[model samples]
Target: MAYTSLYRRYRPDTFRDVIGQEHIVRTLVNQIKSGNIGHAYLFTGTRGTGKTSVAKIFSRAVNCLHPVDGSPCGKCEVCLELALSGNFDILEIDAASNNSVDQIRELTDKINFPPTIGRYKVYIVDEVHMLSKSAHNALLKTLEEPPEHAIFILATTEVHAIPATILSRCLRFDFRLVPTSAIAARIRFIFDEIGVEYEEQAVNMIAAAGQGSVRDALSIADMCVSFCAGNVTYDGVMEVLGTSDPVKLVGFVGNILSGNVDEALKTVAEMCDSGKSMAILASDVAALLRNAIYVKTCETAAEILSLPEEQCAALRALGEKHSVQKMLSVLKTMTATEGEFRYSTQHRILFESAVISAATEAPAAGTTAKERELEQKIAQLERKVQALAKPGFKSAPAKEDAVQVWARVASELQKKGAAFIALAATEAEVESDGGVFRVKVGSSSCMKILTDKSNRDLLNEAFSSVCGQKLVIEEVKKLDEDKSLPYITSMFGKYLEIK
Candidate 1:
């Protein structure tokens, strides 16, 4: 027999077989059993969460002669026929390939035909979002009012691209990413059925790598199975997955934490010589820092870390040696430079420089970590100064609604050209720290308009309406070009000249 990939071979054929999606399965099964199934259904979620599989199973259930607990009985004539690829009753369309209006019209032409082998003609359109605008228009009427004998199941990873008209006509089911525990359980089940010897540690590694995709987990597990030669071990899994060795990861983080610049670069060189990817190395360090943060804060560190017992324990031990601020600095660097290292021909220089910069620099007390890091590097190159609070750095505000409030303030600032200033300041470091709106302008001209004493009260009134408080506005100037649009500039110029 030819080898079928693990994900395909162990694909869930029934609701009972689906992992980590109990909520969706229960609702769907209930609907199927109650015979309250709608004519059109929308299944949306991230890839590998079983949207497509559930669509297939649901198609079978609707047409099956005998459904067991809302799932198709594979033995029934209708179910058996639908299981085959050439079944006329069930049509699986890849909307990605056939996304034009003509294709949609052709499929709609078949809508009047009742199932040749079953009571209903089931159309499963995968990646339904790929349908063009005209194709969507063609689908709207049919989807909203398909014949009694026709059932449409549209699946999409991105439901947002789908028009609201189409959304309103169908029953929408959003799928969540399969959790790690569910993935691990499924992997264990697959390995047992295959009679493959595997360690618990090895299984967890694959599950974590899947990052909440059952399909992804199975693919990694399949690779591990072939690589392990019947006996899967933790080291074998890590090697195949390109995850750094636990010991090396610990050493790399430890060197960075201790500010041993020499040792850190040496470790990077060694890893590179060993053929490990720079991107993976950076990612590993970032993940390690994240797990360390969890270890320090969360009471259930082991439950949260997702690493093997030994590695998790090691992180816990190391957590006591680091502060959250220090870890954040390292994390900021690793994450910021991950993309750079991925594309840089001089990966070694970028990796070393980023780490060295992160280690040597101490971010200001209130600056954003990401922004502050860039500023720190620029400061080093040009020897400029980092500015402190201008006598009154406003204290912390209520919380998350600051952006919404600031937007209102900008709207109110329109009369005084503060609106143009606000729009122009978009590219600058405009942020709300505390209840204060810190508006940094790239152009000095924009800065003058925002900071003009006349516009202050207008901004204050806007803040009052949204926040129920008259907040402060802090202005700073930075290097940037003329950001004002030509139309806005003309309008503002005319208004100012009249005033």
Candidate 2:
């Protein structure tokens, strides 16, 4: 006989065996005990959350001749009869393949027929949201008012795709994502039953890789079991899931938080060379950073993170050495980069760039003394610039020529916070005639800045202070079409040299 997969081999057979869905289980068990089962029920949630599993269990319990606490005894005549593959009392339908209007009509046509062996004829339609509009309309009336002997259980992962009309007619039960701890416990039980040797951390890793899906988790566990040759280990699990080691990930995050770009990139290069995917690496790093933040801020982080004590200690050490803000910034960068991987082919480059960016933005504690020194020098320069812009600064003598007078005015403007205007005016030509000053600038941007009211007022005040009299300011244009010389030389050719 062929080997059965772990998920199928360990599928929940009864409501009692279902994990991580107590709310729905309690309600269904009560309904089964009270005989108040609804005609139509809708089970919705993410895959592997026990919607279909619960539906099958409930179907069996309802038809069981002897139900113990709302669960099928599995030994009664009705239970035995319904357990057969050929039984007509409980039917499982894959709505994905049989989603046409005719298929739905055929199902509705048989609803009036009473159960052959059980009290209710249960129809379990998995992925019911895939049904066509006409098919949904065809089954609407039958679902809304099925005969007393007929029951409908519609299971779907995407509940929003289900029409509101159909949704309103059915009793809805939402299944949540199974917790990692619950999944880990279940894996441990399954491994014990099968006599599979595994490390505790390895089992937890497998459970987390499942991402709250029992089937997905079990599928990964199956691979791990086979790959490890019956002795599952943490390294084996990491290899199977394509994730990094938690200790290495913690160290990688440490490099980032401490602004060690070289070490961080070296780790990334090593992972890439070993055939690890950049996208998965980014996700792992992000999850580790998030956990570190929880350890830093949350009081009960040990309980919340669900990681092993050793791993938590490492994260706690990392969190204690770094601020929450720096970790959050790195986490944000990594998450944003993960989204971009879908659109680009250069995954390694993008990942490396994000790592370098995060490391570069690390807090002051991460900066080198030389970098801090440079930052201080920059601050000093800014203060000097601000100081030079103060009032009461003297200018050139009043006896200076128009060129010298204009140079003095430009220097004063540079000191008074009009640096751009002062720089642009350096290339312009100035002339003084009858106590009127005319200026000509080549570039339109420079002209606009020079013509501004604030800049114009600065220019006028500088001229008044330098030339000992207020001069009328006028902007002029060049009429001589000489393109050989530069703008400055063309305007100030006789006064200046080409050099």
The runs of at least 3 residues in candidate 1 whose Cα sits more than 4 Å from the true structure, single-residue gaps closed, are 99-108, 259-273, 294-320, 335-499
lDDT of 1 by residue, 1-499 (tens): 8999999999999999988788889988998899888888999887888998998899899888889999999999888888887777777777655224333344443556567898878878888776555456556756656778877889987565677899999889988767677888889998999999999989988887776678888999999999999999999999897778877789888878878888888998899899987767776787788677666656555553344567777887776676566776898788668646535788778888987887676633444677556544543322111011111111111121233345445554543555554453332334554335555543344555555676555556655665544354444421111321221122112212110
The lDDT for every candidate, in the order shown, is 0.68, 0.75
Model 2, span 86-199: residue lDDT tens: 677787776655324333344443556778898998989888765554456555756656678878899987575577899999999989768778999999999999999999
Error of 1 at 191 (Å): 1.4
Q: What is the TM-score of each candidate against the true structure?
A: 0.66, 0.66
User: Runs in model 2 with CA error above 4 Å?
Assistant: 99-108, 261-266, 277-279, 294-317, 332-357, 362-499
lDDT of 2: 0.75
Residue pairs in collision within model 2? none
Instruction: State candidate 1's TM-score.
Output: 0.66
